[model samples]
Target chain A: MGQTTAEKIFAAHLRDEPFPGTKVIDIDRVLCHEITTPVAIADLEARGKDRVFDNTKIKAVIDHVTPAKDSKTALQAKMLRDWAHRHDIKDFFDVGRNGVCHAIFPEKGYIRPGFTVIMGDSHTCTHGAFGAFAAGIGTTDLEVGMLKGVCAFREPKTIRINLNGKLPAGVYAKDAILFVIGQIGVNGATDRVIEFHGSVVEAMSMESRMTLCNMAIEAGGTSGICQPDAVTVDYLWPFISGEFASKKAALTEYGKWCADADAAYEKVLDFDMSQIGPQVTYGYKPDCVKPVAEMVGTPVDQVYIGSCTNGRLEDLRIAAKILKGKKIVDSVRGIVSPATPQVFQDALKEGIIDIFMQAGFCVTNPTCGACLGMSNGVLSDGEVCASTTNRNFAGRMGKGGMVHLMSPATAAATALAGSIALAKP
Target chain B: MKKIFGGPVLCLDRSDINTDEIIPAKYLTEVTKEALKPYILEDLSLDGFDAKGAPLKNAQVIVTRGNFGCGSSREHAPWVFEVNNIHTIIAESYARIFRQNMFNCGMLAIELPKAQIDTLVDMAKGGALVVSVDLPAQRISATADGREESFSFELSPFDKALVEAGGWVEFADARY
Candidate 1:
C-alpha cells in the first residue's frame, strides 16, 4: 500500500534501532510563548545544558500574557525574554512585535510544508493546515527538543476526514469542523493524525483551513493537516526572505508530501457540509454544538471573536459585515482581536476595526487573551459568553462562567440580539 | 518504583478534565515549581474537605473516566499530581499529551476499558483500598482477605524500561 502523509513524513525522519517503532526524529521548527517558555528555560538550566540545538530554528513569542497584566506575568515574560537574548536566539518577538504564535508562525514562513513543527502550546497543530506534521508536546519534551534537536515519536495511523460537497448558506468551516467532532466524540481521533480532504476542503481558504486544524486537539487528534496547493504558495510567498529564502525556494521539492491516492487510511469519515448549519456549542465543550437556528434565544452576556481558531482577517471581516451600522445590546460587552500583528494592521487598513468599534465592540491588541480565560474578555459569575474561540470547558473563562462556541457572524448576531442568534445569511 | 502499594484511589468520575482546570493559566506564570502546589485546583468545589479543598491530600492515586486531561499540553497538570505525591492514575483513556506528560514525570497513567475502570473505582470506594501494581509483571492486583483479584495489562517494553529506570531525566542523563 502507498504511504499516507504521516507515514511518508515519519519514514523520512525515522531513527535507527527503533525502526518502525519509537522513532527518534528531528524537529525542524519549535515555537513557544511566555506561558510555556519560562518553564522550558528552567528545564534547560536543570539539565545543565546551556546550549540550544539550533537557535535559529527556535522562536519565542510574547502572546499569552501581553503587557504582562500583573507582576507575576511580567516576571515570566521578562525571564523568557532574558533567556532568549542570552541564548542569542535571533527570532525572538517581543510584545507588539509578536502575536499569537500559531497565527504568526505560518505568516512568517517559520512553519513550512513537509516539515514537522513542535510547540509547547496545544494549538501547535494549527500549523498542520499547511500540509506539515505539526503537533503539541508538553514543556519537558519541548525543552528536550531545544537541547537535543530531536524528539521521540510513535508513528500515528491516519484518519482521513472527507469534507465533501459545498457548504450551504450561513454554514462555514467552523460549523463543519464542529459537526465532524460531534459525530465522533472528543476522543474519536485519539493519537491519530487527521487529514482533511475532499472537494470542499480543496476550495477552503488558508484561514478557514486553519480554523479546522486548530481544533483538532479538541477531538483528541494527534495533529490535523490539509494538503498544500497554490493557495499555500501565494499565502507564504511574501514571507520568503533573509535566512528562509533558500529554504522556502525548495517548497516545490516537497511536492510529494501529500497522501498517496492509493494509501490505506486507518479510517475515513465523510462529512457533507450541505446539511450542516451555523453551529454553536451550548454546553462546556466544543463537541456540544447544535445548530444556531435551534438555539435562537439562549441569553448571552458577552460576545468574543478572536483566538488562534477564529481570529484571522477573514473571521474579522465576517464579523465586521454582520456588525456594521449596528450597536450591540446595551447590557452586552463584545471584544474583537486580530490573530497577529500583521492581521491587525491589515484590518486597520481595511477599516474592519472601525466597523467593530462602531458596533460597540472593543478592539484589543493581538493576544490569546480571554480565549484561555487569562485576560482581556474574561467572564464573571453567572455570565454566558457566545465566543468564536475554541473550548468551552467549565470554569474555562472564569470561576463560574459558561461559554458558547460559535462562528464570528453568529457571535456578532448574538451580541446584537442580546441572546444566542443565527447570523444574517 | 517496582511495586506500588499506592492508591486509596480518589474518584474524579468526570471526563475531559482539562489541564486548565487542574492548573489554571493564571498560575502558569511561575517559571519554577515553586508556589504551584497550593493552586492545583485553585477554585474547585469539593466535599468533605476544608476551605482549601484539595481533596487529593490522602490520595496516592486518582481514578477518572475517559478523555482525562483533554485540553492544552500543559506539563503542569502532571506536576500538580507529582507535587501532591500522587504516584498513579487510572482512567478509561487519556489524551495523548497528558498521558505522555504523566510518563515524563515518572507517574503511572494506566488505561483500561470501562468495565475494568469501574472495577477499580468500585474497589477504591469500599474505603481505603489499594491497587498493588507490579510494574515488571504488567499486572495489578487488589487484595482482600488474603486473596488477590488480579487484572492484566499491556505496557510496551520501551515504556516499561523507562519507568523502571525512572522517567525522562534519568533516561536522558544515561544517554548524554
Candidate 2:
C-alpha cells in the first residue's frame, strides 16, 4: 500500500507499537502555553518527574492572558515562567516577546517537513502546513510529550481534500477553510488527517496555509496538511540556510514528505474554489456557515481581527486595505491585534497600525485574550461580534455574546457598516 | 478503576456540545480541577436544559448526541466532570482530543451508533434511567421504568490499558 504523508511521518517517528492500531511516536517539538501546561507541570512535579525531555525541543509562551488579567492568571503565568526558568528552556517567550503560540513558533522556523509536533492547545495542527505531522493533545499526552518526548496515537487515516479552481478576489484562506468546514460539518473529519491538495492549495502562501490548517480542529481533523514545496522552503530559508547547502537542497529534502501518488485515502473530497464567496458563520457552530449575502445587515456590536487563525500580516494588510480611508461606525467597536511581536512590528513598519487606528479600531498588544473571551475586547451580554477568530461556540467571547466568524476583509467591512457586510471586490 | 461502574444518567439531547459549553474559557485560569466544578456546563444553553437546575445536579453519567465535547482542546472540560464525580459520557461520537482526554483521566467516553444512542435517549426520557457499565463485558445496561435494556460498545486496547493503569500518568510512570 502506498503510504500517505501522515503515515510516512508516523513511520519515521515510530518508537513503539503500544497496541494493535496505536503507535507511540517520538515528538520533534512540544509547544506549551500558560493555560494548559501548568496542569501538566503540576502533575509532573507531584510525580517527581519535573524535568523536560529536551529543553531545546520545547517552546513555551504566555499569550493566553498576557499582562495577567487577574491574580489567578498572573499565578498561572508565574508558574510557567518559574518552570521555564528552572529548566533553563531558552525558547520561552514572555509578555512583550509573546505572540499566539501557533503563530510565533512557526514564525521562528521551529517546525519542519516530516517532523512530529504536539501541543496542549488544539490549534497545534497549524504547524502541519509545513508538511509536518502535528496534532493537538491534552494534559496527559502533553505530560508524556514533555517528559518522555513520545506520545501515542491511533494509526492515521488520510482524507484528501482537493481544492481546485481559483479563489475569488475578496475571498481569503479563512473563507476557503470556513467553506470546507461548512461542507464537511464540524465532525466530518474525525479521527483522520486532512491532506489538502490541488491548485488552490498550491497557490497559497505559507501564512495562508497556516490559517487554513489552524482550524483543522474545528472540523475534528487530527491535522490538516499541505505538501512541502518551494513555498515551504522559502519560509524556512532564513532560519535553515546554514543547515542546507542551498534552497534547492532544502526543497529536495522537504519534498520527500509529500504523499505518494497512489497513497490510500479513506475518502476524497473535491471543492471548487471559484464557486466560494465571502463566508460567515451564523448560529454557534463553526459549520453553521452561509454566504455573506445571506447574513447581510446583521447588526454587530464589535469587530475583532486577530488570533492564531487570521492574525498574520496578510490578514492585517487585507483588513487595513479595506479600512484605509474609512472609519468604523461609532456604535461598533473594532479591535486589531497582530499575532506576534514580529507581525506587530512588521505591520507598524507597513503603516497597518496607523490605518487601523485611523479607522477607529483599538490596537492592542499580541495576546490571545479576546479570541477566547479572556480580555482585550470581550463582548457584553446579548452583544454580537463579527470576528476573524476560529471558533464561534456559544458565549465563546463572552457569557451572553454572539460571535460571527468571517474573513478579515469581511470583518473590516462589518466594522464600517456596524453590521455583517461582505467585502467589496 | 472499577470494571463495573455507572450511575444516574444525564440526558443532554443535543449535538456538538463544545468544550466551551463543557467548561467555559473564563474558568480555565483556575489551577485546580476542583475549582472548575461550579462552572461545569455553566454556559450550556439548550431549550429545556437548565445549567443550574436538576438535570445536571446529579449527573454521574451523561448521554448526549453526536460530537459531544467538540471545539477547544482544553483538558479542563473532562477535568470538570472528574471533579464533579461524573466520569462516563455516552455519545454518538466525540471530538478526538476530548475523547482521548477522557480516557487519559481513567474515565469512560462510550460511543454508540446513532440508532443505539437514539434508543438510549428514548429509554432515558421514559423515566429516570440508571446505567451500569461492565468494562470486562463491554456492555452497558440501562434500567428505567421497570424495563431493562442493554447495549455493547468497544474500546481500543490502548484505551483499555489507560483505564486499567488509572490514567496516562500512572501508565507513563510504569513505562517511562
Q: Which residue pairs collide, candidate 1?
A: none
Per-residue alpha-carbon lDDT of candidate 1 for residues A40-144, written as tens digits (9 for 90 to 100): 787677668767888998988889969789998998899889988998989998987888888888878877778888898888888889888899998877877
Q: Give RMSD (Å) of candidate 2 vs. truth.
A: 1.2
Using Cα atoms, each model's DockQ against the true complex is 0.62, 0.87
**Model 1 accuracy (lDDT, Cα):** 0.81
lDDT of 2 by residue, A1-425 (tens): 78889999999999988789989899999999999999999989988889999999999999999989899999999999999999999999998899999999999999999999999999999999999999999988999999999998899999999999999899889999999999999999987899999899999999999999998889999999999999999999999999999999999999989999989999999999998889999989999999999999999999999999999999999999999999999999999999999999999999999999999999999999999999999889999999999989889999899999999999999999999998887
Query: Residue pairs in steric clash, candidate 2?
Result: none
Regions more than 4 Å wrong, model 1 = A16-20, A240-252, B1-5, B42-55, B144-148
Fnat of candidate 1, please? Answer: 0.63
**Candidate 2 chain A: worst 10 consecutive residues by lDDT?**
A15-24
**Collision count of model 1:** 0
